[model samples]
Target: MWWQAAGILLGAVLGAEVLGRAAGWGALGAGSREGHRVAVTFDDGPSERTPALLAVLARHAVKATFFVTAPASERYPALLRALGVAGHQVEAHGRWHRHALLLSPWREWAQVRWHPRAGGAGPHLYRPPYGGHSPLTRLFARLNRRQIALWDVEGRDWTAEQATTLAARTLERTEPGSVILLHDGPGVTPALLDALLTGLRDRGLEAVTLNDLPTRRITFWAGLWRLASSYGA
Candidate 1:
Protein backbone atom coordinates (compact mmCIF):
# COMPACT_ATOMS: atom_id res chain seq x y z
CA MET A 1 0.00 0.00 0.00
CA TRP A 2 2.86 2.41 0.82
CA TRP A 3 4.59 1.67 -2.49
CA GLN A 4 1.31 2.14 -4.34
CA ALA A 5 0.80 5.52 -2.69
CA ALA A 6 4.33 6.61 -3.63
CA GLY A 7 3.75 5.55 -7.24
CA ILE A 8 0.50 7.49 -7.43
CA LEU A 9 2.21 10.63 -6.07
CA LEU A 10 5.03 10.31 -8.58
CA GLY A 11 2.53 9.83 -11.39
CA ALA A 12 0.63 12.95 -10.33
CA VAL A 13 3.80 15.05 -10.29
CA LEU A 14 4.84 13.76 -13.71
CA GLY A 15 1.39 14.48 -15.12
CA ALA A 16 1.53 18.05 -13.85
CA GLU A 17 4.96 18.60 -15.38
CA VAL A 18 3.84 17.17 -18.69
CA LEU A 19 0.74 19.35 -18.73
CA GLY A 20 2.80 22.46 -17.97
CA ARG A 21 5.27 21.71 -20.75
CA ALA A 22 2.46 21.03 -23.21
CA ALA A 23 0.74 24.29 -22.29
CA GLY A 24 4.01 26.18 -22.71
CA TRP A 25 4.53 24.68 -26.14
CA GLY A 26 0.98 25.58 -27.13
CA ALA A 27 1.51 29.10 -25.79
CA LEU A 28 4.59 29.43 -28.02
CA GLY A 29 2.63 28.15 -31.03
CA ALA A 30 5.03 25.27 -31.37
CA GLY A 31 2.40 23.22 -33.18
CA SER A 32 2.82 25.49 -36.15
CA ARG A 33 2.79 23.92 -39.59
CA GLU A 34 5.48 26.29 -40.75
CA GLY A 35 8.65 24.26 -41.07
CA HIS A 36 12.17 25.16 -39.96
CA ARG A 37 11.28 28.70 -38.92
CA VAL A 38 11.88 30.78 -35.80
CA ALA A 39 10.24 34.07 -34.89
CA VAL A 40 12.90 36.43 -33.49
CA THR A 41 11.22 38.86 -31.08
CA PHE A 42 12.65 41.72 -29.02
CA ASP A 43 11.03 43.27 -25.98
CA ASP A 44 11.37 46.66 -24.16
CA GLY A 45 12.14 48.67 -27.26
CA PRO A 46 12.42 50.87 -29.40
CA SER A 47 15.43 52.17 -27.59
CA GLU A 48 18.34 54.35 -28.78
CA ARG A 49 20.33 51.22 -29.58
CA THR A 50 17.45 49.91 -31.71
CA PRO A 51 18.91 51.53 -34.81
CA ALA A 52 22.12 49.55 -34.48
CA LEU A 53 20.15 46.38 -33.87
CA LEU A 54 17.96 47.12 -36.85
CA ALA A 55 21.05 47.58 -38.98
CA VAL A 56 22.35 44.20 -37.86
CA LEU A 57 19.02 42.58 -38.72
CA ALA A 58 19.09 44.27 -42.08
CA ARG A 59 22.53 42.91 -42.79
CA HIS A 60 21.35 39.40 -41.94
CA ALA A 61 18.11 39.97 -43.90
CA VAL A 62 16.17 38.84 -40.83
CA LYS A 63 12.81 40.31 -39.92
CA ALA A 64 11.95 40.30 -36.21
CA THR A 65 8.98 41.17 -34.00
CA PHE A 66 9.27 44.04 -31.50
CA PHE A 67 6.88 44.13 -28.51
CA VAL A 68 7.23 47.76 -27.52
CA THR A 69 5.79 49.68 -24.60
CA ALA A 70 3.55 52.73 -25.11
CA PRO A 71 6.16 55.16 -23.73
CA ALA A 72 8.92 53.76 -25.92
CA SER A 73 6.78 53.96 -29.05
CA GLU A 74 5.74 57.50 -28.16
CA ARG A 75 9.31 58.58 -27.27
CA TYR A 76 10.76 57.09 -30.43
CA PRO A 77 7.98 57.26 -32.96
CA ALA A 78 10.56 57.57 -35.72
CA LEU A 79 12.21 54.37 -34.53
CA LEU A 80 8.85 52.61 -34.55
CA ARG A 81 8.28 53.84 -38.08
CA ALA A 82 11.73 52.66 -39.02
CA LEU A 83 10.93 49.18 -37.71
CA GLY A 84 7.74 49.02 -39.77
CA VAL A 85 9.54 50.32 -42.84
CA ALA A 86 12.34 47.82 -42.32
CA GLY A 87 9.77 44.97 -42.59
CA HIS A 88 9.75 44.08 -38.89
CA GLN A 89 6.53 43.47 -36.97
CA VAL A 90 5.57 45.78 -34.10
CA GLU A 91 3.23 44.66 -31.30
CA ALA A 92 2.22 45.61 -27.74
CA HIS A 93 4.45 45.10 -24.70
CA GLY A 94 2.27 47.03 -22.20
CA ARG A 95 1.93 50.77 -21.45
CA TRP A 96 5.15 50.57 -19.49
CA HIS A 97 7.28 47.53 -18.74
CA ARG A 98 5.19 46.90 -15.60
CA HIS A 99 4.01 43.40 -14.72
CA ALA A 100 0.43 42.49 -15.60
CA LEU A 101 -0.06 40.82 -12.20
CA LEU A 102 0.31 44.24 -10.58
CA LEU A 103 -2.34 45.95 -12.68
CA SER A 104 -6.13 46.04 -12.50
CA PRO A 105 -8.35 44.95 -15.40
CA TRP A 106 -9.07 48.53 -16.42
CA ARG A 107 -5.39 49.49 -16.35
CA GLU A 108 -4.42 46.42 -18.37
CA TRP A 109 -7.21 47.12 -20.83
CA ALA A 110 -5.99 50.68 -21.19
CA GLN A 111 -2.44 49.55 -21.87
CA VAL A 112 -3.47 47.15 -24.63
CA ARG A 113 -5.86 49.66 -26.14
CA TRP A 114 -3.34 52.48 -26.11
CA HIS A 115 -0.25 50.58 -27.29
CA PRO A 116 -1.60 49.37 -30.64
CA ARG A 117 -2.47 52.90 -31.73
CA ALA A 118 0.93 54.16 -30.49
CA GLY A 119 2.53 52.23 -33.31
CA GLY A 120 0.88 53.38 -36.52
CA ALA A 121 0.05 49.83 -37.63
CA GLY A 122 0.62 46.26 -36.38
CA PRO A 123 -0.93 42.86 -35.75
CA HIS A 124 -2.42 42.14 -32.34
CA LEU A 125 0.32 40.11 -30.67
CA TYR A 126 0.59 40.79 -26.94
CA ARG A 127 3.45 39.66 -24.77
CA PRO A 128 2.99 40.39 -21.09
CA PRO A 129 5.74 42.03 -19.08
CA TYR A 130 7.81 39.48 -17.14
CA GLY A 131 6.09 36.67 -19.19
CA GLY A 132 3.61 36.01 -16.41
CA HIS A 133 0.00 36.39 -17.43
CA SER A 134 -2.77 37.40 -15.03
CA PRO A 135 -6.57 37.46 -15.27
CA LEU A 136 -6.45 41.03 -16.55
CA THR A 137 -4.03 40.05 -19.29
CA ARG A 138 -6.35 37.29 -20.44
CA LEU A 139 -9.39 39.53 -20.33
CA PHE A 140 -7.66 42.23 -22.35
CA ALA A 141 -6.41 39.70 -24.86
CA ARG A 142 -9.92 38.40 -25.43
CA LEU A 143 -11.50 41.83 -25.55
CA ASN A 144 -8.89 43.32 -27.87
CA ARG A 145 -8.75 40.29 -30.20
CA ARG A 146 -5.05 39.81 -29.51
CA GLN A 147 -2.98 36.69 -29.36
CA ILE A 148 -0.81 36.02 -26.30
CA ALA A 149 2.74 35.34 -27.44
CA LEU A 150 5.55 33.63 -25.56
CA TRP A 151 9.05 32.62 -26.56
CA ASP A 152 10.27 29.05 -26.91
CA VAL A 153 13.89 30.17 -26.82
CA GLU A 154 15.62 33.09 -25.11
CA GLY A 155 19.12 34.50 -25.43
CA ARG A 156 19.00 36.23 -22.02
CA ASP A 157 20.91 39.04 -23.68
CA TRP A 158 19.52 41.58 -21.20
CA THR A 159 21.75 40.20 -18.45
CA ALA A 160 24.86 41.65 -20.09
CA GLU A 161 26.10 38.15 -20.68
CA GLN A 162 28.77 37.40 -23.24
CA ALA A 163 27.60 37.01 -26.81
CA THR A 164 28.97 33.49 -26.99
CA THR A 165 26.96 32.45 -23.94
CA LEU A 166 23.78 34.00 -25.24
CA ALA A 167 24.18 32.49 -28.68
CA ALA A 168 24.85 29.08 -27.15
CA ARG A 169 21.75 29.26 -25.01
CA THR A 170 19.60 30.32 -27.97
CA LEU A 171 20.96 27.64 -30.27
CA GLU A 172 20.60 24.95 -27.62
CA ARG A 173 16.92 25.68 -27.13
CA THR A 174 16.05 26.30 -30.78
CA GLU A 175 13.96 23.91 -32.85
CA PRO A 176 11.52 24.14 -35.70
CA GLY A 177 8.89 26.82 -35.02
CA SER A 178 10.82 28.15 -32.06
CA VAL A 179 10.27 31.75 -31.04
CA ILE A 180 13.50 33.35 -29.83
CA LEU A 181 13.47 36.31 -27.45
CA LEU A 182 16.18 38.93 -27.72
CA HIS A 183 16.61 42.56 -26.64
CA ASP A 184 17.63 45.74 -28.43
CA GLY A 185 19.34 47.40 -25.50
CA PRO A 186 23.02 48.05 -24.81
CA GLY A 187 23.23 44.59 -23.37
CA VAL A 188 22.77 43.14 -26.87
CA THR A 189 25.38 44.81 -29.02
CA PRO A 190 25.68 44.56 -32.79
CA ALA A 191 28.60 42.20 -32.44
CA LEU A 192 26.57 39.84 -30.26
CA LEU A 193 23.74 39.91 -32.75
CA ASP A 194 26.16 39.17 -35.54
CA ALA A 195 27.41 36.16 -33.65
CA LEU A 196 23.92 34.93 -32.84
CA LEU A 197 22.58 35.38 -36.34
CA THR A 198 25.67 33.78 -37.84
CA GLY A 199 25.20 30.81 -35.54
CA LEU A 200 21.53 30.53 -36.54
CA ARG A 201 22.48 30.60 -40.18
CA ASP A 202 25.06 27.92 -39.61
CA ARG A 203 22.31 25.79 -38.14
CA GLY A 204 20.15 26.56 -41.18
CA LEU A 205 17.48 28.25 -39.12
CA GLU A 206 15.73 31.25 -40.61
CA ALA A 207 14.51 34.06 -38.38
CA VAL A 208 11.04 35.46 -38.99
CA THR A 209 8.37 37.58 -37.30
CA LEU A 210 5.31 36.47 -35.33
CA ASN A 211 3.17 37.31 -38.32
CA ASP A 212 4.93 34.53 -40.17
CA LEU A 213 3.96 31.88 -37.62
CA PRO A 214 1.33 29.30 -38.57
CA THR A 215 -2.19 30.06 -37.37
CA ARG A 216 -2.89 28.16 -34.16
CA ARG A 217 -5.11 30.20 -31.91
CA ILE A 218 -6.06 28.74 -28.53
CA THR A 219 -9.75 28.78 -27.64
CA PHE A 220 -11.05 30.72 -24.63
CA TRP A 221 -11.60 27.67 -22.45
CA ALA A 222 -8.20 26.25 -23.42
CA GLY A 223 -6.52 29.54 -22.64
CA LEU A 224 -8.20 29.73 -19.26
CA TRP A 225 -7.27 26.13 -18.48
CA ARG A 226 -3.64 26.82 -19.28
CA LEU A 227 -3.60 29.99 -17.17
CA ALA A 228 -5.18 28.17 -14.25
CA SER A 229 -2.84 25.20 -14.56
CA SER A 230 0.16 27.51 -14.79
CA TYR A 231 -0.81 29.40 -11.65
CA GLY A 232 -1.72 26.23 -9.83
CA ALA A 233 1.62 24.71 -10.72
Candidate 2:
Protein backbone atom coordinates (compact mmCIF):
# COMPACT_ATOMS: atom_id res chain seq x y z
CA MET A 1 0.00 0.00 0.00
CA TRP A 2 2.80 2.44 0.90
CA TRP A 3 4.67 1.63 -2.28
CA GLN A 4 1.54 2.17 -4.34
CA ALA A 5 0.98 5.57 -2.80
CA ALA A 6 4.62 6.52 -3.43
CA GLY A 7 4.34 5.40 -7.02
CA ILE A 8 1.24 7.52 -7.49
CA LEU A 9 3.01 10.58 -6.10
CA LEU A 10 6.03 10.02 -8.35
CA GLY A 11 3.80 9.73 -11.36
CA ALA A 12 2.10 12.98 -10.48
CA VAL A 13 5.39 14.82 -10.22
CA LEU A 14 6.64 13.46 -13.53
CA GLY A 15 3.37 14.27 -15.23
CA ALA A 16 3.49 17.82 -13.97
CA GLU A 17 7.05 18.24 -15.21
CA VAL A 18 6.18 16.98 -18.65
CA LEU A 19 2.76 18.52 -19.15
CA GLY A 20 2.73 21.62 -17.00
CA ARG A 21 6.40 22.58 -16.91
CA ALA A 22 7.93 21.21 -20.09
CA ALA A 23 5.00 21.06 -22.45
CA GLY A 24 3.93 24.48 -21.21
CA TRP A 25 0.34 23.67 -21.99
CA GLY A 26 -1.61 26.78 -22.99
CA ALA A 27 1.51 28.98 -22.94
CA LEU A 28 3.21 30.94 -25.74
CA GLY A 29 6.76 29.72 -26.14
CA ALA A 30 7.52 30.47 -29.79
CA GLY A 31 6.33 32.59 -32.69
CA SER A 32 4.89 31.96 -36.16
CA ARG A 33 6.97 30.11 -38.74
CA GLU A 34 6.25 32.44 -41.68
CA GLY A 35 8.95 35.06 -41.06
CA HIS A 36 12.66 35.59 -40.67
CA ARG A 37 12.25 36.94 -37.19
CA VAL A 38 12.91 36.12 -33.51
CA ALA A 39 12.04 37.74 -30.20
CA VAL A 40 14.80 38.53 -27.71
CA THR A 41 13.77 38.56 -24.07
CA PHE A 42 15.81 39.43 -20.97
CA ASP A 43 14.85 38.63 -17.42
CA ASP A 44 15.83 39.55 -13.82
CA GLY A 45 16.63 43.14 -14.61
CA PRO A 46 16.61 46.85 -14.17
CA SER A 47 20.09 46.10 -12.92
CA GLU A 48 23.23 48.26 -13.26
CA ARG A 49 24.17 46.39 -16.43
CA THR A 50 20.84 47.18 -18.09
CA PRO A 51 21.98 50.58 -19.32
CA ALA A 52 24.79 48.99 -21.28
CA LEU A 53 22.39 46.38 -22.61
CA LEU A 54 20.01 49.13 -23.67
CA ALA A 55 22.87 50.95 -25.40
CA VAL A 56 23.73 47.84 -27.37
CA LEU A 57 20.08 47.38 -28.39
CA ALA A 58 19.87 51.04 -29.41
CA ARG A 59 23.02 50.75 -31.50
CA HIS A 60 21.36 47.90 -33.36
CA ALA A 61 18.07 49.82 -33.57
CA VAL A 62 16.29 46.86 -32.04
CA LYS A 63 13.48 46.59 -29.53
CA ALA A 64 13.21 43.80 -26.95
CA THR A 65 11.11 42.62 -24.00
CA PHE A 66 12.31 42.84 -20.39
CA PHE A 67 10.78 40.78 -17.58
CA VAL A 68 11.80 42.77 -14.59
CA THR A 69 11.43 41.48 -11.03
CA ALA A 70 9.34 43.54 -8.62
CA PRO A 71 12.22 44.18 -6.23
CA ALA A 72 14.56 45.19 -8.99
CA SER A 73 11.96 47.43 -10.59
CA GLU A 74 11.20 49.09 -7.31
CA ARG A 75 14.89 49.54 -6.53
CA TYR A 76 15.61 51.11 -9.88
CA PRO A 77 12.48 52.90 -10.93
CA ALA A 78 14.38 55.24 -13.21
CA LEU A 79 15.97 52.38 -15.14
CA LEU A 80 12.55 50.73 -15.46
CA ARG A 81 11.18 53.96 -16.89
CA ALA A 82 14.19 54.15 -19.19
CA LEU A 83 13.23 50.74 -20.62
CA GLY A 84 9.75 52.01 -21.38
CA VAL A 85 11.09 55.32 -22.72
CA ALA A 86 13.37 53.37 -25.06
CA GLY A 87 10.24 51.75 -26.51
CA HIS A 88 10.94 48.28 -25.19
CA GLN A 89 8.16 46.07 -23.81
CA VAL A 90 8.15 45.79 -20.03
CA GLU A 91 6.55 42.75 -18.41
CA ALA A 92 6.53 40.84 -15.11
CA HIS A 93 9.10 38.31 -13.90
CA GLY A 94 7.43 37.83 -10.49
CA ARG A 95 7.70 39.64 -7.15
CA TRP A 96 10.73 37.55 -6.24
CA HIS A 97 13.22 35.58 -8.31
CA ARG A 98 12.19 32.20 -6.90
CA HIS A 99 11.03 29.32 -9.03
CA ALA A 100 7.31 28.77 -9.23
CA LEU A 101 7.61 25.06 -8.52
CA LEU A 102 9.05 25.87 -5.13
CA LEU A 103 6.38 28.32 -4.06
CA SER A 104 3.18 27.77 -2.09
CA PRO A 105 -0.06 28.19 -4.00
CA TRP A 106 -0.90 31.49 -2.32
CA ARG A 107 2.58 32.90 -2.91
CA GLU A 108 2.45 31.72 -6.47
CA TRP A 109 -0.90 33.45 -6.94
CA ALA A 110 0.58 36.70 -5.62
CA GLN A 111 3.59 36.24 -7.85
CA VAL A 112 1.38 35.95 -10.88
CA ARG A 113 -0.80 38.87 -9.81
CA TRP A 114 1.93 41.32 -8.79
CA HIS A 115 3.05 43.89 -11.37
CA PRO A 116 5.54 46.70 -11.13
CA ARG A 117 4.17 50.17 -10.53
CA ALA A 118 6.20 51.53 -13.42
CA GLY A 119 5.74 48.61 -15.80
CA GLY A 120 4.70 50.16 -19.08
CA ALA A 121 1.75 49.06 -21.17
CA GLY A 122 2.19 45.69 -22.81
CA PRO A 123 0.53 42.30 -23.08
CA HIS A 124 0.21 40.46 -19.77
CA LEU A 125 3.28 38.26 -20.13
CA TYR A 126 4.93 36.43 -17.24
CA ARG A 127 8.00 34.21 -17.38
CA PRO A 128 8.37 32.20 -14.22
CA PRO A 129 11.89 32.12 -12.84
CA TYR A 130 13.82 29.32 -14.58
CA GLY A 131 10.75 28.68 -16.76
CA GLY A 132 9.42 26.40 -14.05
CA HIS A 133 5.82 25.68 -13.18
CA SER A 134 4.07 24.20 -10.21
CA PRO A 135 0.69 22.43 -10.26
CA LEU A 136 -1.02 25.77 -9.84
CA THR A 137 1.29 28.01 -11.86
CA ARG A 138 -0.65 27.89 -15.10
CA LEU A 139 -3.99 28.09 -13.34
CA PHE A 140 -2.86 31.18 -11.45
CA ALA A 141 -1.57 32.75 -14.65
CA ARG A 142 -4.86 32.18 -16.42
CA LEU A 143 -6.89 33.48 -13.51
CA ASN A 144 -4.74 36.63 -13.54
CA ARG A 145 -4.98 36.82 -17.34
CA ARG A 146 -1.18 36.51 -17.73
CA GLN A 147 0.30 34.49 -20.51
CA ILE A 148 3.31 32.40 -19.57
CA ALA A 149 6.24 33.24 -21.84
CA LEU A 150 8.95 30.63 -22.34
CA TRP A 151 11.87 30.52 -24.74
CA ASP A 152 13.02 28.15 -27.45
CA VAL A 153 16.68 29.21 -27.54
CA GLU A 154 18.58 30.00 -24.39
CA GLY A 155 21.51 32.44 -24.73
CA ARG A 156 23.19 30.93 -21.63
CA ASP A 157 25.09 34.16 -21.07
CA TRP A 158 25.06 33.37 -17.38
CA THR A 159 27.67 30.70 -18.01
CA ALA A 160 31.44 31.29 -17.95
CA GLU A 161 31.76 31.04 -21.72
CA GLN A 162 33.07 34.06 -23.61
CA ALA A 163 30.66 36.29 -25.44
CA THR A 164 31.78 35.25 -28.91
CA THR A 165 31.38 31.57 -28.14
CA LEU A 166 27.95 32.10 -26.66
CA ALA A 167 26.92 34.17 -29.65
CA ALA A 168 28.05 31.55 -32.15
CA ARG A 169 26.30 28.71 -30.36
CA THR A 170 23.11 30.69 -29.97
CA LEU A 171 23.14 31.56 -33.67
CA GLU A 172 23.65 27.94 -34.65
CA ARG A 173 20.62 26.79 -32.67
CA THR A 174 18.35 29.73 -33.49
CA GLU A 175 15.76 29.43 -36.25
CA PRO A 176 12.89 31.53 -37.44
CA GLY A 177 10.27 32.18 -34.72
CA SER A 178 12.63 31.31 -31.89
CA VAL A 179 12.31 33.17 -28.62
CA ILE A 180 15.76 33.78 -27.12
CA LEU A 181 16.29 33.84 -23.38
CA LEU A 182 19.03 36.02 -21.94
CA HIS A 183 19.48 37.94 -18.72
CA ASP A 184 20.13 41.63 -18.04
CA GLY A 185 22.27 41.16 -14.92
CA PRO A 186 25.11 39.22 -16.48
CA GLY A 187 28.27 41.13 -17.33
CA VAL A 188 28.84 39.17 -20.51
CA THR A 189 25.32 39.82 -21.80
CA PRO A 190 25.93 43.18 -23.43
CA ALA A 191 28.77 41.81 -25.52
CA LEU A 192 26.81 38.69 -26.26
CA LEU A 193 23.84 40.86 -27.20
CA ASP A 194 26.01 42.82 -29.62
CA ALA A 195 27.40 39.71 -31.22
CA LEU A 196 23.99 38.03 -31.37
CA LEU A 197 22.40 41.02 -33.06
CA THR A 198 25.22 41.17 -35.60
CA GLY A 199 24.85 37.48 -36.33
CA LEU A 200 21.07 37.81 -36.66
CA ARG A 201 21.65 40.62 -39.14
CA ASP A 202 24.08 38.49 -41.10
CA ARG A 203 21.47 35.75 -41.28
CA GLY A 204 18.81 38.28 -42.30
CA LEU A 205 16.72 37.53 -39.23
CA GLU A 206 15.11 40.53 -37.58
CA ALA A 207 15.18 40.66 -33.77
CA VAL A 208 12.01 42.13 -32.32
CA THR A 209 10.14 42.33 -29.06
CA LEU A 210 7.73 39.58 -28.08
CA ASN A 211 4.87 42.01 -28.56
CA ASP A 212 5.89 42.47 -32.20
CA LEU A 213 6.70 38.84 -32.90
CA PRO A 214 4.08 36.94 -34.93
CA THR A 215 3.27 34.16 -32.50
CA ARG A 216 1.33 30.91 -32.26
CA ARG A 217 0.41 28.39 -29.59
CA ILE A 218 3.12 26.04 -28.33
CA THR A 219 2.33 22.67 -29.81
CA PHE A 220 2.83 19.46 -27.85
CA TRP A 221 5.72 18.28 -30.02
CA ALA A 222 7.35 21.68 -29.93
CA GLY A 223 7.09 21.85 -26.16
CA LEU A 224 8.61 18.38 -25.88
CA TRP A 225 11.49 19.49 -28.07
CA ARG A 226 12.04 22.55 -25.94
CA LEU A 227 11.98 20.45 -22.78
CA ALA A 228 14.45 17.96 -24.20
CA SER A 229 16.79 20.68 -25.37
CA SER A 230 16.69 22.52 -22.05
CA TYR A 231 18.41 19.88 -20.06
CA GLY A 232 22.12 20.73 -19.12
CA ALA A 233 21.59 23.99 -20.99
Residue-by-residue lDDT tens digits, candidate 2, 95-159: 98998767887998999998764254545888899887776787798888788888878999989
Q: What lDDT score goes with residue 139 in model 1?
A: 54
lDDT (0 to 1) per candidate: 0.72, 0.87
Candidate that would win on lDDT? 2
Clashing pairs in model 1? none
